[model samples]
Target: MVSLTRISEYVAQTANIIGGVLELDVLIVDRSLRIIGDSDLASVSEEECIRKDSILAKVMAEKEQIILSSKEHNAGCASCLQRNLCMVEMIIGIPIFFESKILGSIGIIANTLYDKEKMINNQENYLKFIDRMIELLTNRLKEEQALEEISLLKKRMEVVLDSIDDFLVLVSRDGEILQTNLNFKNIFKRKKPKYLNEVLCADVVDQLLNDSEEVKFKEVKVNKIHDFLLSSKPVIVDQKDHGALLSFKSIKDVAVEMNELYTHSMDVVFDDLVGESPQINMVKERIKQIASSSSTVLIDGETGTGKEVIARLIHNTSTRSNAPFVAINCSAIPEDLMESELFGYEEGAFSGAKKGGKIGKFQLASGGTIFLDEIGEMALHLQSKLLRVLQERQVNKIGGLESTEVDVRILAATNKRLEDLVKQGRFREDLYYRLKVIPITSPPLRERKDDIRLLVDYFISYYASRIGKDINGISDNAMGILMEHPWKGNVRELRNVIEFSINMSTGDMITQTSLPFDLVHPTQEYDEDLNIEVVTQRLIEKALIKYGDSTIAKEMAAKSLGISVATLYRKMKELDLKNSIG
Candidate 1:
């Protein structure tokens, strides 16, 4: 191994091995750029050899190995007529290395008398081929080492699971308790279980065996002392009947773990919401109240208000916390595919349908909450379908004849006023009433202006960690501007503004300069934003004065505007001008 460090020794040692099987002379070289070693042979002498002079020197200089096949091409071999009788038709050579880092060269010189057929067939001439063999051996060694390390890890994990106080049970296919790390022996103390056939409880194992071979298993709701909490996963591998892994844990511990996972998985949390005013506190209180309820919830807020955050908070605090809480924006879905997305169709239900059918939002959230965002944007047609499902407590697939009973609790959030929509014939009044059963409204960020500092500080630290920098907090001047801004886009807008500020921040502080140009210099034209009532009053007064106190003014106003006289009368009543003369 030490000698092989230089190319010269490696070539000599390798050549010696080949020489034992075949008649050939060989030489090796080290990167010393010197002749470290060589095979002392009969057809070659140290004094007559082309070693130190320049043959190997040229190979090193060019970063490539040299091959001399015929004595005719070599002036040195040409003089020695033994070349014509040489065995090799031509010598083949290649460079040697590991991971692109070159080591050295290995070469064999055969007499013209050597076997012609065998020389061409043997890869013994290419030094790179030998390097490849070394690599394969290295990989195999690594794989074996990895397998050993994994075995050690599994053993250590087993020990750790055993040390915990919870009921950690690992079961097998034949109804055997392969391993029980929990205090099951002390808790149950069963001579047998109530079901019998229960191997853990010896007496019940016989009855369970009568059912036949165990193909599948489930580990659910196993308790330690009582129902603190637990996470169980069945070992479903490659169609094999492995058992399950059941664990016992506290509810608080699960929450902590989930919070940890959120830090790693989700970029933002409830803290990213910008609001601290009493109105915002009221929204939080409503959310807290809604969290404990198992009934349907309807969250109403303006477009920019954070309805999505309220839904997330509800999900996080609810009884179905372990199940997935999926959100689907009804407005974002394309009309044609919306039905299939909500109530999945079987394969071939449509040309592009997937095999074995698809699971819809309700099925995906079987035991969880489904938040339908922008619910009012759903077509007037789908509203009826949704209403049917809500009323019957079931959903039928797009093409399926049978209905699936889903235990999902619905949470529909919308910015649009459904009550107004119902009156305009854009939404069904019956469906609107059903959805508005437990209404909760989120106030706009401007209304909750007090939350500005809390949100800004949260975002600064949040984005700082995300960007791997230290943006300590928002500056006092920056905070004041943030509080004063009208935040028309509400919490969503505030998040964007804060994110923009943090991105522009330097030396651990954010300032006004970081704000977008439009935000700093708003270009709102006051003329375009006309007061509806003032416009109506001016038109009314002019019409009344022009027509000389006639009732025709109201009729003319309604007719010209393409509205009913009754609607115009209602508007006048609202403005206290129902039957007034100019």
Candidate 2:
């Protein structure tokens, strides 16, 4: 609703002009019948100026003009209770209308006989002048309302632009900086530049202004120092170029986003290794000591000895844990594509290359760690390129002229010894030494037999929960079979065995009957000394040596031997093995 008070000043000025020209008092009242403008000091107060029975009120109610000469006989003022107080002999009232709605009324009053005669003689001209004044006041109010709405819309647009995370700028077609978002202002310390060239290079600005389609470029230098990924889209309206909207993302931020997109949700932490043996503890301590370093690491171990697990643990415990931990199995990918897979490739590098090129594991692992498993399997030609990357801390994409700098920590694992491979001319000596800056060896399960019990308990609980079973523990007979079997496949093989046993077991406990057939009944040669007593004595002696001669050791040895501690003690006493301790 448009209020007449919004144009109160214009109403006052219009009333003064008409009153001065016609030599009569003028008064203006709003739609609510409240006087808002008065040309002369009226004897009546503002609240009492307009009455229900006044001529001005009748004109507004009827949405028309009214002219009266005699206040006592005019029908427009006959019912006015305050008509006696009104000092007027003639009156002209015109109602203001806008959009078919009456906003207010304008009245011309004649207090003297000469003024009354003057108004009655020129009543037509007086109405015409007041009508023109109403039109001007209505137009003024519309303009003010439009300006207010535009201001509100501009504020809303600014808020929307500032909410973006990336630095954004609106520029003219001639590269003039028009407006910028909050991120851009923050980066520049709230000091706005005059043109795009003040922040971006001339060539980049040129490409943004001239390109018809959306333009995107990475590693673009900002202010000749910092690198950013820039993208621009021309603002086209009705087949005319207005300007361009540019967005800048930090290269480091882009790398982090890519890492998140490419990373898996394995959630492998340092504690997930789950071992208490000396060999395993030593490996864990070594990882903790060097977790903050950025040097290259070389891990050598037998297959299934948890080399990749150790690498992941190191990454998880390091400062770069929040970033990506990319693992590439050299033996898994083909040798022909190993180079491209390691160092990325250009769009047209090879015959069947992907259209937009592909980012390699190293690039994806930037600002974090990359593990190269089975490094010995990498070809000699690729080794040279790998050496160059390690030496320069940069990578050259295939069929690309420039090298891209990478801030990645390299970690390589192999089941075979790189030293022996280098001696055999299969691996480069320089590259081997470079990778061995921090060498670690993952101990096989056989060497860390002390951790077997813990590993068994962990795997049992894990597999049982995963398979939704109630199996709680492994029986002595089942554990004895596992302790005696040599695990050539190490932890991986042990895990599979436990999973198989859990699946095969029908009861709440895993027993020897649930074991694999080949594991429970292995082929054995006939013994030359077939005496039962001698065999039993020899087995007891061996168990005593393997475990200590303490009472707890005897209990553990008895469990491994698939016997009770009391039976083992009885046999020891019968065999006269007196070296046992309580």
Candidate 3:
């Protein structure tokens, strides 16, 4: 049984390729005698399908490979002149095939050179390959159509079984278990079987079905059966009742049932993000401004600083929130497959490519956000092609003749310093400018001590629910230790530490003892803290001497030093530098 869809599609494509090679139209049809695939540039009509003079119909009826020529067929058949006027006017000859037994016929119409034996051999090989495919498709269709009918029958049987207090089972005439709903497994402590091999109805009545007195069908297995009052009825579909279907549930039973249930939740939201300090606030504000615009965003940050999360937030908050937010880890994707993963490839494009071809991430994320995480790891050669896509807004698949127009918003993230990369001539400077139209940096956890309390409390609650425990908040000492520690891995590391402590701690409050060994243990502090007043005075004096005193503002000096202006002003006051202020 060759799959009609695939066979028809291939036949159509081959017809076109052969048609192009020889100059003609191509058509493919299925067994229901309907045209399923057509490669003709000219339009076709539905009624043209049943025309007796058509090459496809002749191929199906004759059960042989064919090459139909307009010159010969129209002159021979009476009904063919009209068909010639309607179809195959330009077709000098086309290959039509009857590939398999019981599988639908495929007719490829082409005005091409006739190499009949070779073309027929190709069709036979294709048919053999698609035999299993057609069977699977046909079986799936049968199951789908039967689903609704079977579901209704099961519901009707539920009431009859509810009246009984014990397990019930119904086996077939051949002693094969045909139907078992969720109830029998629960009541009798029987695992719902993957398949029923030799279970019969009579065996079930004697062994599993409770209340022999309640049984209404006298024979248990009858030639022609109908409904019996307050008892199971024969399940029917399209006037034919399938094997016995019985339903029974128990009020109390333990089957030791367990399943690995999984839930996929998008737990990361913009509000879950920590950081209110000014250094981070400026970046957040800039992200907010740029998120609304359709410009390409390049997020630069150190590893584990939540670049991907920030990228997600921008996508979730933007105008395209309803559309897909597809993320591709550029570094993780293999270099050899990266091209196909981005631009997709056509059927028979390369060895091992799927027959019908694949749709790429770009096509999948059309009109949505595509997050290219770890983009600095993208290959240099691919970077040039990527730049072309950003500029062109379209992509051509591998071996595909046409380009598909895409309107995808790019939001690329990287932990690598791209500016340094561009300066070193590793990354294209043009692409850098294209992506850096808006850049957002997530402040590392150590940079914002004030927000540590909020983050700790959040993680405490989060981890508690996750591990199925309810613990009290962190103590002041634990909080102090947390704030004192430098978070190299940022918030991600902090969350892990909290989770570990919560798992280890039995008491309500997270004490210093419960904290990880690294944090709980003390280390020597940096002894030589620089003189703030002297350092700021010298810095501001130097800047003012060159740029002029009035031009060099307190805010400018503080920013240049990568320190707080408040700290700088405090230093200015201590050094008597305010006396020189306007």
lDDT winner: 2
TM-score top scorer: 2
Ranking, lDDT, top scorer first: 2, 1, 3
Give a tens-digit lDDT track for model 1, residues 1-582: 222342333344555655555454445444444333344543323334343333454455566767654546655455655656645455433344444544444455554545434455574544444455335433444555567689899888778876786666665555556666545444566542332134233422332233323322211122222323333455668976465654545333443454446433433245544466788778777777777777788898887787887777777788876666667899999978888778777545878876435557776566677889998888888888889888987888776877877677789998866765675578899988887878888887776677777776776777778877777776677777777778878777877887877777666677778776677777754466589887776666555443332346558767765668787677667877745632
Candidate 2 lands at a TM-score of: 0.72
Residues 315-353, model 3: lDDT tens digits? 777887656667789999899999999887876699998
Q: What is the lDDT of residue 158 in candidate 3?
A: 68
Q: What's the true lDDT of residue 179 in model 2?
A: 90
Model 3, residue 103: what's the lDDT? 38
Badly placed stretches (over 4 Å) of model 2 are 1-150, 261-264, 334-364, 398-404, 496-507, 510-582
lDDT winner between candidates 2 and 3: 2
Rank ordering of all candidates by TM-score, starting from the highest: 2, 1, 3
| TM, every model | 0.48, 0.72, 0.46
Model 1 weakest 10-residue run by lDDT: 215-224
Off by over 4 Å in 3: 1-264, 522-582
Model 3 residue 100 lDDT score: 35
TM-score of 1: 0.48
Q: Model 2 shows how many backbone clashes? A: 0
